[model samples]
Target chain A: MSNFINQILQSEKTLAFPIMTHPGIEALGKTVREAVSDGEIHYQAIKYISEHFDTIACTSIMDLTVEAEAFGAIINLPEHEVPSVTGRLVNDLKSVGSLEVPTLDKGRIPQYLLANKLAAENIRSKPVFSGCIGPFSLAGRLYDMSEILMDIYIEPDVVNQLLEKCTEFLVNYCRALKATGTTGVIIAEPAAGLLSDDDCMMYSTVFVKQIVDAVQDDNFTVILHNCGNTGHCTNAMIASGARALHFGNAINMEDVLKQCPENVVVIGNLNPVGVFKQGTESSVRKATQKLMTETAGYKNFVISSGCDLPPFVPEENIRVFLETVKSNNV
Target chain B: MSSELLTKLSECVEFGKINLASPYPPQMKGLPGADEITKEALESGVTPGEILNDALISAMNKVGQKFSENKIFVPQMLLSAKAMGASMIHLKPFFANGSVQRKGVFILGTVFGDLHDIGKNLFGMMVEGAGWEVIDLGIDVKIEKFVEAVKQNPTAVVGISALLTTTMVNMKPVIEAIKAISPDTKVIVGGAPLSSDFAAQIGADGYGKNPQEGIVWLDKLTA
Candidate 1:
């Protein structure tokens, strides 16, 4: 249970899990439209990625809209791009009473679950982790983000009820993910990063703590991700009781490492959008080398992208990101 | 009392004291907030232009500076922007009647194939709070939309935002289209995937690291 996560965290070799799949899909000569729509192709993309990198774990696409869509939010899926929630599902609190926790079979949940199960069967080299939207972020999608923020001030009980519903769905979703034999789950909460520390603690972390307790253990752990959190909420995120904390490119990584508990694994945070997908091979190597040197002192720090890699990261840059991590041996 | 009220309005915008009714920040409950102070200033014989220039514009400039210095985060910025928005409801009529002149027009949007607009909205609000008319073309905006917009507002500065590296590259063509249509219009770029270097690489006249920096650059470009 603890084998892969422990080995990667404690070992002298730094690992690379760029939260990527577009590159792998492209490697298969398939478009993202095909991969995202088909579970088998998505798994094959993960398998292709496993053969190419020193990864702590292979992750499914961090599609933040899947759970929202399942919750009855309308989602817009472009032919070859990341899907986004189009409109609010629970627009009013009174309407929130009519909301029901969606069955796992609803929406694209089955496809993602099958993709995880297949990735677990095929990727023998490292642990496989499933990704899901975090509770507050899900609620943000269900009720538009800007409205939710104001609603918190104007309508506290309503926001609380919506978060309660989001957590219930996420808990069941993560358990189903655990049944897939993946090592753990990475719960992404980028939208929560938009909240203040206090607001995040109240609205995001408390719910995240519920999901973490429900899903994490020696065998399976929960990695809490918040790419939108620049700085103010790191304390609340650590307090949320997730076994691992994944940050994005916005904050200074070394500062995050300093505040984090040494026992917990701290994974991060290359700018996947800026450096990896956009940079050349030499540029990736230079950025990786610089970050490696900067955070070398931290024991639990695992080298990773700031957020999910875009659907078109260059192959050479991905290779250099992996190789640079391997050569550092920090 | 007039200067004091205007200064308080600026402070309210800075600390996100939205209204007398807003319970945030704890210490300022029942105290007049930006909404109250702006209304009070307007009724105290201060011209609508003075309120816009002396308080709202000055306050947003401070807010942008604080944002750049990491003195505040997005939530606070959002609150202040909301507060400014509440105050603007009072001053909007003056602008319509031509008593309050806008500094310039900024046409902004998220590039085509991108749906994310948090950054774009933030910049739009900040630029608007700085006394500019923000012509926001919503998400997934194409190059033709930009060129047509450029055709309408020939002298306007254009702002492009893209959260994904894939979509950020789309800015190059949009910039080209706008330039080809109106050679003098300057395009500024910013987002999660973008840096000053990328902005320059894409041939944008300017790169705003954040919403504040973007507003500051727009000020310089218009100047």
Candidate 2:
């Protein structure tokens, strides 16, 4: 296990590791587009958030589009919103064979790498984790999410071919992120959560495990983040051998904790939208305390937003969330 | 023979056997799939309504129930939908000639600023399979477009979807606009970020946690 995981496991206090960074654009006076596209702005946003919040680690923007964009997928960059892949790039087996594995220099990757490098250098107090879209999620973006889901059954070999290329690219990408002095990379595989447990094991877990094995060591870690899982594929996720598991708010954290091994750090599952972006300060406090109390018996539980905090999540709500977690320290 | 064909067709739809050539489900290999079975049922003098009600609708309901119970996930549900679509091709002519009647019209869309449509499309397919005429407006649907769709199909139930927390807030105005144009029109809202409380807060007539729940609400409306 990495020292990062060891520290989290040994800590008595419930740690806060919300997948946050976008809201720091509020202080930077920058739009979402500017922050995502520019390295300095992205670094500054992470810096600002880490300085303000007492988090165990600082995470980069959980933008799922950056790696897809690097793979030559057309991205829709909204000025104030997280970007999305507008359409698919590959549709057939021939195209999958022809798809190129991009280098770190491709499409805003350098910018993201620079952001993480800067965060690693500057944020000395806490571990800095860079974020990337997981292999299956990136492949889904390249082949279209709906189309790929059906393709998994219709053309298993073709989907496997595409997944091989995706896994290859991600292994290299995570290696590059590791070279940037960051502590680890959080592979966001929300797309795989749409699969049944067996299918998830076949198409997602196998590839994620490959990446986990390729880049993870004592000095670095792999944290698997799946916001789309509804409790069906927790075993598949655990089998990936990631050092930590991060969940979204779609399932009950207590149930997931029961399925998880006590030594592996299990982080997550406060509703980022319902309780943070849309709820009142009192609601944030109540939700945080409720989650903490529900999983209070588990030593490995970490209190966090179920997913990345959206751009306009109220600052007061975030403040209340942190304060509540701190005040109710186990 | 006709009843056997209908049973076979329903099994094809439930198991996602698209056609004879499809290699899925491993055990069902070399047998006819939904496409061929549906055609054989029609040629053997099975009524179109029987094929639809007994095969397509019955199979899709099982798919929905399995989905709601987590016995299956999206990939399996979508394959079942594809199989149903194959059978529906044989039944479309009957609907056009008024030999068969649909339950009602359901107008669906993902609200503006949200491009996610996996949920919307799945629900649309399920509704279509359940004998409802579905007018899917696609993603990033503006409020005016929804109001216009409601204006055309005034009695139709409106189902709006938004997958993002940031975009789900957009559901409020779209629901309000549809209600303004047709107050009696029932509007249902769904998405990852939505809740029953959020649906009521936004004046939605109902909230569907999944496509099956949405179908249940739609069935209750006409029942």
Best by DockQ: 2
True contacts kept of each: 0.36, 0.72
In terms of docking quality, model 2 is: medium
Poorly placed runs, candidate 1 (over 4 Å): B17-37
Q: Write the per-residue lDDT of candidate 1 for residues B1-223, one digit (tens) a residue.
A: 7788888888888777889888765677678888888898888987788778888899888888887776776767877888888888888898889888998889999999898887898899999999998899999999999999999998899999998766888999999889887888989998877888888888999998888788878888667
Estimate the TM-score for candidate 1: 0.94
The stretch of ten residues in a row with the least summed lDDT in candidate 2 chain A is: A19-28
Give lDDT: candidate 1, residue A17: 69
| Per-residue lDDT over B87-167 for candidate 2, one digit per residue giving the tens place of the 0 to 100 score | 899888999999988898899999999999889999999999898989999999999999999999988999999988778
Candidate 1 reaches a DockQ of 0.47
> Interface Cα RMSD for all candidates?
2.4, 1.1
Q: lDDT per residue, candidate 1, A1-330, as tens digits?
A: 355557756777666667887777888988776677688988998888888766667888878888988888888877677888886688786789789989999888899999999998888888888999998888888888877876677568899999999899999999999999999999999888878788889999999999988988888988899998898899989988988889998888899989898877888888886788778888899999998888987878888998888887778887888888888873
lDDT of candidates 1 onward, in order = 0.85, 0.91
What is the C-alpha lDDT profile of model 2 across A130-211, one tens digit per residue?
9999888999999989889998988889899999988998999899899999999999999999999899999999999999
lDDT of 2: 0.91
